[model samples]
Target: MSFIQTLNDAWSRTQSLLCVGLDPEPAKFPAALNGRPDAIFEFCKTIVDATAPYASSFKPQIAYFAAHRAEDQLEALIAHIHEKHAGIPVILDAKRGDIGSTAEQYAKEAFERYKADAVTVNPYMGFDSIEPYLAHEGKGVIVLCRTSNAGGSDLQFLSTSDGKPLYQVVAQLAAQKWNDNGQLGLVVGATFPKEIETVRGIVGDMPLLIPGIGAQGGDVEATVRAGRTANGAGMLINSSRAIIYAGKGDDYAQAAAEAAKKTRDTINQYR
Candidate 1:
């Protein structure tokens, strides 16, 4: 199946729009798992296994793995999710962008090397930087539109000649221009519901990978109210620390599962 179909099937099967983030921070790991060479992988595997029942997808932020030089572990984690969870889509949140050959290599790393079902891409360099990922046929190319970080507005919210914000323009380009294979999606932060709504208006039913909930304090009710598509299935609300680090004990996985379940239920409540 294609990325969109896989994601939709997972959403239907799990009855969730929640996407648990596998961002394993070494210092924040459970006491027993901390300082171990395999801590990152072990922690991520546990989170995936625990949240699989409640999650429509799992997003592993690549920087965490790269920082620890644990790319092999990331590969193992993605493979494990595919083997065990079946339909749950794994999005490698790499946010990569570059010119021509470099972009091609990045696409290869995301889809071939790590085998991520989808990936987050930075579009700052324009369409050429994004096209290589789009050429990967069934894999998803989620272009960064409106990000969740505090400094995102520095570029994303700038007005163009047509008076539309740069993010809206990105949404327009993603929906109207780049989505040739029905695999394009947008990254709209849940932290800004109004921005989410604006992008939704431009993109219609295109998938939105929304982050900044839980730890970043994005309002769940506002997110659901603003980001939900006409079919009530476009948004993937993500939570990292709040879910994965819910506990620092041996029962951390269980606590993470509970957190995932609660996040899923809370999102569904508003849907």
Candidate 2:
């Protein structure tokens, strides 16, 4: 299935919009697994299994693994998701942006090497930087629009000649010009619910990979009201630290499950 179809199917099957983000940090790991080899994989795998029932998708931030020299663990983690969770898509949160061969190599890294179902990318480099990923048919190329960080406004809010913010222009391009394959999505921060509403209006029913809900304090009700489609199914509401690190002991996985379930239920209430 295409990335969008698989995402929509997962949404229907799981009846949840919650996207479990895996951003493992060894310093934050529980005592039982803190110094263990391949602990990154072990920690994320446990969370995946515990929260699979409530998740519509999983997003693994690549920097977390790479920073710890755990790239192989990241690969294993994604493969485990494909094997155990089946239809649940994995989005590689790499935010890669380059042109020509460099972009192609990055695309290969995300799809061929990591086997990510989709990837978050920086569109600051323009359309050519994105075309290489589109070349990989059925894979999702999610462009960063209004990111969650406050520093994002430094560039994303700049005015264009048409009196529109840069992020809005990016949304317009992704929705109209750049979405030829119907596999594109936008990363609109849940922190900016009003911007999300503006982007949703521009993009129609395109899928949105929303971050900032849990640890970043994005409001669930406002996010849903602004981002959901007519069917209440166009957003992937992500919560990472609040869910994965809910417990610091041996029962961390169970605690994570509880947090995920609560988040899923809270999101469903608005839908």
Candidate 3:
């Protein structure tokens, strides 16, 4: 199936819009697993096993694995998720962007090497940097639009000559010109609900991968109110630290599972 079809199927099968971020920091691992070369993988495996039932998708931020030189572990985790929970999609959050040959290699890394169903791409270099990823049939390329970080306003919110924010211009371009494959999506932070609503209007039914909900203080109800499509299923609300680090003890996996369930249900309530 195509990336969009796979994602929609996962959402329907799980009845969830929650995308658990498998960003394992070595420092945050449980005491027993901390400092181990394989701690990140072990922690993520347990978290995925526990939270898969409540998740529509899993997003593994590549930096966490790359920082520790755990590429093998990252590959293993994706394989494990595919093996055990075939219905759920895996999005590799690499945010890669470059020109020409480099862009092709990044696409190869995300879709061929790591075998992710989707990837987050940086759009600063414009369409050519994004086209390689889109060239891969059935793989998704999610462009970074209005990010959640405090510094995102530095560039994204700048007013263009037409009185439109840079991000709004990006939204218009992405929706109109770059989505030929029908696998395009935007990363709009949940922290910016009004922005989410505006981007939603621009993109129509295209999916939005929203972060900053949990630990970052983004309001869940506000996110749902602004991000959801008319059918109430166009957004994937992500929570990382809040769910994964809910506990530091032996029951960490259980705590993460409970947190995932609560988040999924909370999102459902507003839907």
Pairs in steric clash, model 1: none
Instruction: Give residue 10's error in model 2 in angstroms.
Output: 0.4
lDDT of 2 by residue, 87-164 (tens): 999999999999778999999999999999999999989999999999998899999999999999999999999999
lDDT to native, each model = 0.91, 0.96, 0.93
Worst 10-residue lDDT window for candidate 1 reads 29-38
Per-residue lDDT tens digits for candidate 1, residues 1-271, read 7888887788778899999998888888878886688889899999899888899999999999999899999999999999999888899999999997899999999999999999999989988998899888789989999999999999899999999889989999999988888898999998899999989889888899999999999999999999998777888899999999998889999999999999999999998
TM-score of each: 0.98, 0.99, 0.99
**Rank ordering of all candidates by TM-score, starting from the highest:** 2, 3, 1
RMSD of each: 0.9, 0.6, 0.8
Which ranges of candidate 2 are over 4 A from the true structure? none
lDDT of 3 by residue, 1-271 (tens): 8888997888888999999998888887879895677888899999999999999999999999999899999999999999999989999999999996799999999989899999999889999999989889999889999999999999999999999999999999999999998989999998899999999999998889999999999999999999998878988889999999998999999999999999999999998
Which residue pairs show backbone clashes in model 3?
Answer: none
State how far residue 105 of model 1 sits from its true place (Å): 0.3
CA lDDT of 207 in candidate 1?
91
